[model samples]
Target: MAASLIGRHFFIQSRNRRTLTLKSRLKYSSAVQAVSNEDVESLYPPVKPRFPPGNWTSMTEEEAWTRYEAMQEMTAVPTVKERLEKLTKKQMRAYRFPVNNKSVRVLEFQKNVTKSHLIKGLPTVYDSLQVDSLILEKIKPYIIEVLLLEKERLFRSRFRDIHRDSLILRNLIQTLLPLLYEHNTALRTSQVDEEVDIKGFWDRSGFKRVMWYDPEMERPKEFRIKYANDVRFQTAHVCDVSIRTENPLKEFLPIDDELCINEEFPVLEYHPKVFGTSKTDREKSQLTPGYNLGDPCEFGLVSFHNTVWLDYQRRKYGDAVTEEMRQGMGLTASFTWLLAQAYSQGFNSLLDVTYPMTTQTVLSDGQKMSFFAYQLNTIDMLKNNMANPRQNICWYTDETQLYEKIEDGKVIGFNDETCETLLKFLLMKPERRNINMKPTLPAESSDILSETEFISRNPLDLSTETN
Candidate 1:
């Protein structure tokens, strides 16, 4: 019986060993499968390259095509030469001259008067007063007609359709004609004062003093004298006239009239000496010895002429005056000219014409020195005259183009074409730039502090301590 028990125990041990071997093999196979799977995953990674190099990745295909179309549209518009041709053709078709006329003599006389000024040396020989009178007489009807027609058209057109060129021309004519009339009238009434010391009066005032005998008075009893405080006064008379008032015995003459005699009032002048002096003081003060003799209105006109020349450069060569140009001219001179031009042109709003994301410096001084970059907004009056008027054009800031430049949380430079396109888009309407999303964080979420945090920090005992 003992032998039989031993045999059974041996059999049980053998079976147990076989089972252990099978279990060990299964464990080894499972581990090998896991490691093989891991190796396969490492060979083929999930991450991919965002985009190919040197191509715009942010814009979708549709968006890119849209931008390209806009660029083409801007370039496809008629050139200046084509526009000029069309305009000339239109004008020729619109107007017709009468073939038969008794008015030939009148036309001849008008032509002679207009041509007289163009003849060499004739302008210098003929009294400016006579020349101006003749010019005015010949053009008066034409001027009146143009003004009336323009006014009627302006009234008919919507405010947005108003053209800047027409507005500028109108302003120039309106400001100039009245002064010319006044000057001519003054010239007509003027008389040579044989007895009076004209030289002495002029020496005292630093200007030529002219005496005009009143037309109504007999024997030149009542006289009108006009003088200037400075030699530089050109269009502006600054007339300090000693008029024959009703009361002759009144010793000190009553201040006659403070008239801005220039056709263009507030004419820009370069007077380095007058820089520090107040306008009131400059008008009141007499020219003295050792004073700096600065450039007058003539100089201002010359400067304007130079600016016009520069404009021609821009139109013809596309060589516009940049920030570098401003630097070449002294800062003061550049800014002064800029302000004068802007004011003269009646630009109510100026675009800061700097690169995108650039900041401008504004002096704290009350002299209104503020540097801003913007695109010019232009209104077209001629288009307004047409059946369908184009909308007002304004400058817009391009956020999408700018966004592409933003790196490391800051914007760098902008593409010129893109900037120009955006500006043109803005010029079409009066609306502010549409962001389509909030630029700044909302008020509620901006600050980190919360009511729950404050309440949780309060001092309160939850359980009593054992004594």
Candidate 2:
């Protein structure tokens, strides 16, 4: 019986060993399968390369047509008209002011009479006064028309539409601003091709040229630079649209009334010398003292933000004015006037220490227009150049209302101060003290101009040429 029991135990142990061998074989097989699966995944990855680097030939016409037809059936391509509609109407919400031929009023300035005509009652040999007036008058209508048209374009655009919205503003300055020079016989604009590259030209022009002084080197340094990606979008280059006016005023302001406009008033001459180029202070400057002349091309750069945030409010309250809008208009008007002065004086030298010039800025909020005047006393921009430079303009500005509002086309509640400011800027020349004498004259000319230099506080003080 003992022998039988031992034999049975040995049989059980043998069965157990067989079961263990079967389990080990199965485990080995599973491990091999797992490795094979991993290898398969590595060989055929899920991610497809977007641009496969191989010389693959084009598919056959049948395959191509099948794919094209499938795409056409799945989706439709939008029309150009639909795309343009989305861009203009839905994007900008642009509209225009009520303008027509009747909206235009011929602003007549009394034909400027010559001093000789008044004293001797005889026309000079060369009487261009009528021609100048006629030419100047023709440009006024053109200016008004352009301004009205641009306002329509500007007010309609979304500010973020940087390309479409800013295009007209840029065009206004680049294309239209030079039109003012059309009437002036003393000035002529270059016929710059629209397609020409002007980036290099603007970088060095007197107006756009912004520079600094490197104290370490003790020399004036130019910090203006262009990045590789800094490209203007379909905009005319500064050089392409820049108007370079040639003035012989380096020797004189024409004594002949026919050659000059409003000879009774002062004609501001651009100082021939370039200022703000010096590394040293004004007192230590070896160069003749003058204000750095600005380029005519950059003069008309008046920008206004198209505040998307205020659009809802503006729509709710039609023809309403906000503080932000007022501020923007003020800035735009100021820049406009500044450019006007720059363009006017382009033939004359730039402003200088010899004769300081004051210009009035008129800001309109479509409802009401305000006015502010700034006198450029100096352009020694390098005096305190750390990171930012100091503004060289002097403050002679007085807060005044230009018009209460515009009812139809007429100006309502026109402020006398507004009239005076307009007259001073439009009629009276900013720097007219040397109107009679040549700018290069060794002798001193008459000091008939009042001590105030520009517009007065009292509106009644209009007895001067500013009236």
Top TM-score prediction, candidate number: 2
Query: lDDT tens digits, residues 175-266, model 1?
Result: 33353444333222222111111110011111232333334422223332333222221011111111111111110111121120112212
Q: How much lDDT does candidate 2 score?
A: 0.29
CA RMSD of each candidate after superposition: 38.6, 31.3
lDDT of 1 at 414: 33
Q: TM-scores, in order shown?
A: 0.14, 0.25
Off by over 4 Å in 2: 1-169, 173-179, 186-372, 378-467
| lDDT (tens digit, per residue) of candidate 2 on 232-338 | 01111121122222221121122222322221332112211121111212221011001122222222211222223334445654433333333333332332233
Query: Against the hidden true structure, what lDDT does model 1 obtain?
Result: 0.24
Error of 1 at 140 (Å): 1.1
lDDT top scorer: 2
Q: Give all candidates' CA lDDT scores.
A: 0.24, 0.29
Separately for all candidates shown, the number of backbone clashes (residues 3 or more apart, or on different chains) is 16, 8
